[model samples]
Target: MMTAERHFLADDVPDRVRVGVADLAVATGETRVTTSGLGSCVGVAVADPESGVAGLAHVMLPDATGDDRGKPAKSVEAGVERLLAELEAAGGDPERAEAKLAGGSKMFDFSGVSEGVGERNVERTRTALGERDVPIVAEDVGGDYGRSVELIPETWTLTVTSTHKGAEEL
Candidate 1:
């Protein structure tokens, strides 16, 4: 539920706006937004390069249909809704939006509560974005490690970084 302190980046430089687990952030101008420590949680990033508007959400669960006990970004459905709204508020056009997703790794394998959580998170993310008519241009999901993501809206780039996979930009 926290957005990083605004940084005045000159032309989408490397200055980052960091978000935490189950948190969401929106940037209007030139800046990179990032989030970390994603294991079995999804990082959803969306952007409109034309407006230099973008948003990021760290989602931990598949759904929050009737649950309101925590931040909206803690769940896939609400997080997508909120993130899109925030981007539009920041002058992003939904019709021109594209998405990049990363992180949904099964970092642990406990029999009690760790089955398919990552898969479900990714599924819900796709479904939510589909409903909003936002196309997923690229993705780096499903694995056995952790990931962190950074989004630079001016170039509409989403960078996925992990200890195991180095770094990739989408």
Candidate 2:
């Protein structure tokens, strides 16, 4: 009998393919994958089917600060913007791409964190996508458990897995 291989390590990012975490990636016929742990942080994936380009955004906040402007785009809004621009540069149509959101768990009580950064991140992402008219095809948000998310560019699929929750197909 043949034994199947048990996977452990992450697959490497393809050449000329960019993987974004609160960042962007663009590729044609190339697979772009990104992963993140969500303990409150929201994991966002944006993909353009035509270009086979995808990006991931691990956003921790709703908006960016003045200092953030100089830093790499990491906020929900800036992250999406950067992803869009990179996709456009890589021959992706902004109008053709769709978004997927995951993560954002109330794993711990913050006492008083003001706005629940996790929820804020989720709401901000929704608002941003709505404004751009980009449809959010799937999501796994707001819970008491942490999650890990992966975006596969080839199939434009976002998979969410968790220790206690097993796995969710999205």
* Clashes (candidate 1): 0
lDDT of each: 0.83, 0.67
Candidate 2: give the clashing pairs: 22-57
Give per-residue CA lDDT, model 1, range 53-74, as digits (tens).
Answer: 8889999889775765667687
Model 2 lDDT at residue 11: 44
Output the lDDT of residue 9, model 1: 31
C-alpha positional error of residue 130 in candidate 1 after TM-score superposition, expressed in Å: 0.7
For every model shown, what is its TM-score relative to the native structure? Answer: 0.88, 0.80
Displacement of residue 117 (Cα, Å) in model 1 is 0.6
Compare the candidates by TM-score and give the number of the best one: 1
Candidate 2 lDDT tens digits, 114-170 = 447788888988998888888999998988788877667667877788886788777
Worst 10 residues of 2 by lDDT: 1-10
RMSD of each: 3.0, 8.0
